[model samples]
Target: MNSKKLLLYSSVFAIQGLSNAVIPILPELAGEGSTSPAVSSLLYSGYFIGALLTLLPFGILADRIGNLKVVSLGITLTLISGIFISISDNLWVLGISRFVEGLGCGAFFPAAYSMIADWKDSHQSLGEFNFLLNAGLAAGVFFSGMLAELEIKTAINIFTLLAFLSFIFLLRETRGQTPDNSGRKKDEYGTSKRVKPPGEPHENRTGFKPGMYLEKTRETFFENGFWKLWGISVVLYGATGVLNSNYADYSAGFLTKPELGFAISASYLAAMLSSLAAGKTKAKNKSIIRAGIVLAAAGILFSLKVPLLAFFLIGAGGGAAVLGLVAAVSRVSSSGIAMGLFNTGIYAGLGLIPVFGSLFIGPLGYESVFLGSGLVLLTTLFVKFE
Candidate 1:
């Protein structure tokens, strides 16, 4: 990987870390603002919405143009969102800004994934890309946790600055790599017609357009052997979100300190360290993904009572499972569009699980969150390797 790619990946990791660190602290923010839990969740929820809206379009734009340009725009927007959130006094302001930030974040992963895929055409190189991207994500999570321990305002300020600086570092390196505007012939798909770019001088230019859009949605639910993986992803994410949302409260109320940012941060650290081992097993795609789900479920179950080591297991399990799944999916898909579908599947889990988890919280309390996640993982046993 070149320095530019490295920096770009690093900026993404840091941004993800900074933004994600906000999850565990939502409750705290809620109390500070005297808002309800549901309302506070909106802050987190808004981010996902931003992701949902921006992810698809940004990805298509990246494919149409250049990934580096998309990334540059994303980083700038992210910095602005962070700063806006840092200075805002009202929850709505913060929420909207976070949503905007989420949009930026939405662009980050897809563009980054596309770049990595385009850059490295080999499996080994793909593993390296996953490792580096995950490393940046881990580092960001750790720093976010550490920073959140400070005054929320102060932490936001510093994080915003760090995000800006990181973007600058990345922007300098990712110079060329933009989309080709010149007229070029379309590439070969597995089927009859070649996939053409829009506005090309051709017959229909409408090959598999409907099918292309529906690929992820259809496969995720209706396709054979997809339910298991999809179910696991959905459940795992919901469980993670629920637990993450409430962890600070659990720690402040029952465990060692009022601040569990470090605990949360530890999960990212564990993930970072675990990737060192997980990356080695990328060649064994299916096995690694299943192992990740199992580990994550087990970790969540264990952490229900054991506060001291909760994050360690959580980090190890979640990090390994997600990275494994990503590696597996990247290999399965030959084109960038398929990669977007993979991301959408994972983010769907990230997006939907918390909403479901929220419904169970009233009487169920925090432990149920883990149970829900575990149940979700049980489906992983059925996921097909293809």
Candidate 2:
């Protein structure tokens, strides 16, 4: 409901955009430095690992400290990491910088989402908010790819500058919204209002016990069907990551390198378009989830043909499918923990499964990875909706 919150959300989303922009270009950059594909893939994987580790803690911290502080800290880290990467000549140093960057970027989503959850009026509007987030990311990735063609280092330079700008804007914009209990005032009823600090022990007056995060956890899991929906989301996100991390590499062998870049850009364009549409769609959760799964499965299946046109179509389909999934996930939960868990599964799947895929892919080939990821999605398709 707050314009300032929305603006801050936009900045957090732009961080995602900047990260996505750099992802597709990593392979080429690694190749330029004579790093192997596996090592190059690690550049991406390391960031996810960093993200996976930090998501929960960051979410908890955001709930306690306030989203703006956490987000500002994260952006500072991102900017520093980018500067580190810009100067590094060795792959290992670059990888370390990326891992640290991921920790910062990883926290941004849940922190920002938590803020949005705290601010928004209707719960359903999260789908639209997420659409905006994804749009920022889509545009970020698109620009990253477009910028990389000029020089990968230069692209990083631009992103680093953007990060600084974001930090400044966020500092100015969120000045009054800090979650620190010290600055807040209480109402006349002695209710001790103003959303209690996330880490503080609320008195028994609130009808919930202290030291019972586990109780809320249990309620969300078994009682609320959180696990069922979360399981499906994990699989979908993993599959999407597989597509994202590899699209440029696979297509490069067929198309000119620049065309491969264009294809990757096109995939994000598809995502950007779909996210925009998702912002407008009135579809129910059931229909959207089903459609997303089907589209994703179909995209993976179509990608097996290995034709240039098929690649483009599959990317577009997968993008649309994921847009649907984002809409679906945003509908279910508002907590940063929920967002963090959802993201953890997705990134974990993306980060870890590829290890297995790499092993089998060498023997069974690229098509197997596509089929296998699709089969995983197909299994999820039959899962009973929560």
Candidate No. with top lDDT: 1
- Please provide the root mean square deviation of candidate 2 (C-alpha atoms, Å): 5.0
Stretch of 10 with least lDDT, candidate 1: 184-193
Question: For residues 1-386, could you state the per-residue lDDT of candidate 1 as single tens digits?
Answer: 55655566567656765676565556655565333445555666777767867776787766655565677778887899988877776777887897888888788777766655544343554565556555555544444555554665555566688788877786555443332456432221112133445324322334435465566556544444444454556666666665665566545566432235556666767777777788775357677766766766677777677754777777787777777766655555445555555556666666656666665666676577657766776676675655
For model 2, the stretches where C-alpha displacement exceeds 4 angstroms are: 1-10, 32-35, 120-132, 171-211, 275-284, 304-336
Give the poorly placed runs of model 1, Cα more than 4 Å off. 1-3, 32-35, 120-150, 167-228, 255-259, 282-284, 382-386
How many steric overlaps are in each model, in order?
Answer: 2, 2
TM-score: model 1 vs. ground truth = 0.78
